[model samples]
Target: MAGLGGTKMKNTWQQVKKVGIVHRLLSFWSRDWFLKVVSIWLAIVLWVLVGGEDTIEKTVNVPVEIINLPRGLVVSNQYKKKIEVSLTGPRSVILDMDDRNIVRQVDLSKATPGTMVVNNDVDHIDVPRSLTVQRVQPPSIILSIDKLVQKQYAVVANTVGDVAPGFEVKSIRMNPEYVMITGPGSVLSQLSALQTSYISLDGFRRSEQLQVPLDLSPAIVSLIGETSVTADIVVGLVVAVKTVELPLVVQEKGLSLLPKTVSVTASFPQILLDKGKKAKDLLVAHAERYGQTDQFNVIVTSQNNEEFPVKVISVLPRRVSEGKAKLLRATTKKKSE
Candidate 1:
């Protein structure tokens, strides 16, 4: 009975050891264990799909960006602002990218005026980590850079409505006469004329200076100094005109006059006529010393006793002829007499 009892103990110990081994083996196949194995397998599968040998080559249009240009420098030529990028990477990564995800940037912080070719390098492009840049469609870009410059342009007053009745706008003058502007060279070349803010002369009767803003489009140009300019509107009493016939002195020997005598109308300040500066004398003097163009005009003295200003009001025949055959017959007859 003792031996049989010992044998039973041994058999129980063996069975217990066998059961423990079986439990250990079954624990390896539990739900948590299966989950861990599946996670590792999925990680390998994802690696193969995203970073592995299954790569796709595709061409996508990416925006070309210019950054950090030096002060007073600009791109002056029309160029392709976009580029095509050929990418080689996992299918999942390459197909999911759009223009927003990738870009080719050119830095012009140290660029100077001239033509330059910029190469597309990996460092200049931004792309996803999983994708490889096979090539850039343009491979390079050509840029024409120029220095921004300042220019002066005459400003013309744009007026609305006429001066008050019986009071004429004698003269309009700008204080500065010109405006200084700064812009890109190409843009400045297109701008040859400039205008001022609309001024209304409807009921104006007095000589006054007005502060008017310069009408400039801010998109392409910038004002250098003052944006507002002074417009001098001179108004005076309108003088009635007296008409007279005056002989023109031919400045050039071979010059011909269209008409022997020109009808001249003079509008002078009442005080000048009161002081014995007759309209006939002033008109004859003006016709005698008319030096600028072939046409003669009616002029008023800018100031007291000064030479007549070159303000041309009107001329009858708008043109002059060359050659002695068309010279004035009256002048010839007077010379002969």
Candidate 2:
């Protein structure tokens, strides 16, 4: 019985030993460092087989923006503003790039008043990767456009200087007072008024005609067209002459309570004087009675063939009694050439 027990015990011990050996071999192969190294090598071989160093070419459509345009002006040409890029690169890099990375620039400085077409050249794009441009979709674009117009504005007149001595300017008048302008709407909108040059009338004695130039504001002039306009101005002058008092002389058949003398007043040039005309020729008289006034118009004629350059003065009463006679004193004045 003891021998049999020993055999059983020994067999069990051998089985335990075999189990320990198997566990030791398994632990060696399952270590973290060994598995990590094997995985890295396997990934490298797979990448090599898939052409990791090789580049792939592809074309893409990238949208871009334009800048610096005049106010009210629109971009009417697409090809001039947009571009398509044909790029060849590693698939990973190319697929990761944003549209903005591949840019297109179009210059519009020389643009005119009509539709413009812009054709983008794929070669202009600068790609940092091992990539080559392949194609551009919609190679060109068209832009439509129009010109803008400005509005009319008012101009103020500035006057200077005085009229002749003893005379004054009563008023001034202008024809076609305002000026019209045409240009870009943005610039025209900023202008509120126009101004004329300084007008000097320093020593003028009689009525005169003047021509003044119209000056436009910078905002209005920038966008103007070929058409232009002129402004017409008219200045009026009023003069005051020297005046004197003259007495009236009444000598009619109807006589009643006659007055010793009556006076009249007149205005004329201070340089010229002639006094050889009768009262009827140079003076007029009138009378009022019972709230009714009588008026008369007198014509002055030289009776002595000597031109009495004098004009009729106003009567003292302006009117007298119908049946009374009255005498008037006369004053003379000289006239200008």
Candidate 3:
């Protein structure tokens, strides 16, 4: 009972204080009814006029971002990456604006192949709500949309300059013979094959493995996945023709060549010829291989029959008499002494 009594007394005292405060407020307002109202309204009007006059206008560049782009579509033509915006707001707000975070987004979800003009609007810009966007520069932007194309192209290897003087390229090969590329249809449709950057073969004497890059302009097109490919170049010594006379040989007892020696033109690797090798040491002319003593074809072969050793190009007076065939053996034997 004692606690309840104390609580009632505290509530009565709080109510009395509240009533007294309200009575004084009413009395103060009643004292200057019309004049006080005018003064309060005038103060508000002055604050509004001063604040509106203190606003400033500023121009800023906001990066443009493409959003909601449809599938199988690409922006073919070059377009502005950023848009310029002019904004006006309270001086304090403009000075404290986070301009770096401002961005203008252009939506392309409804775009298709061809040219499209999208009008720039303040709604596209993201700025502080307290700041007002007065105007956006570049009333509109033009976009060229193209169908995204994907294709597989054969990789053609290209080489520039010559191999070493005595060397030649046997074959040029690429590891990935074909590549898949995705790009705008405008360019990809006109191209048939993709070529690699020209590989230099200057003074190259042996087979080599090289990293070759593709010939692609990033501004126009792009390769899928791989930027470069492995190149396998097969190099070999150049084959050269060498002409020399060799003594004709016949094993048959009844025949010999009319001319004791025959001019033989044969092909050899440049390295072999550089060694100053004698024709007789590298090759032999046998008339018996044809099994005919009269008017037989001159068969020339390597002495040791080595690999890629020799290739006969021509033989002067390729035929011989049956009786002359016997003289060839005698001439060779006589030279042996």
Give the best candidate by TM-score: 3
Better of 1 and 3 by lDDT: 3
Q: How well does candidate 3 score on lDDT at residue 102?
A: 74
lDDT, candidate 1, equals: 0.70
Worst 10 residues of 2 by lDDT: 328-337
TM-score of each: 0.42, 0.34, 0.59
Sort every candidate by lDDT, greatest first. Answer: 3, 1, 2
Best-first order by TM-score:
3, 1, 2
Which runs of model 1 end up more than 4 angstroms from their true locations?
Answer: 1-57, 99-101, 156-179, 185-192, 195-240, 243-337
Q: In candidate 1, how many Å is residue 46 off?
A: 3.0
| RMSD values, in order shown | 17.7, 18.5, 13.3
lDDT tens readout by residue for model 1, 76-188: 77678888778888776676785355777788988999998999875567887777787786778899898889898888888899876556788999877886667678777
| Per-residue lDDT over 1-337 for candidate 2, one digit per residue giving the tens place of the 0 to 100 score | 9999999999999999999999997886778867778899999998974566567666666655554555556542223334557777777777766744566655566665677776655665567646676777666666554356647677566677765553456555444466676654545566677656666767765566566665555444544422233333333323113333333333434432234334545544332322332333343332234344333222232232222243444444444454332221111112221
lDDT of 3 by residue, 109-154 (tens): 9998999998888887778776788888787889989998888888
Give me the candidate number with maximum lDDT: 3
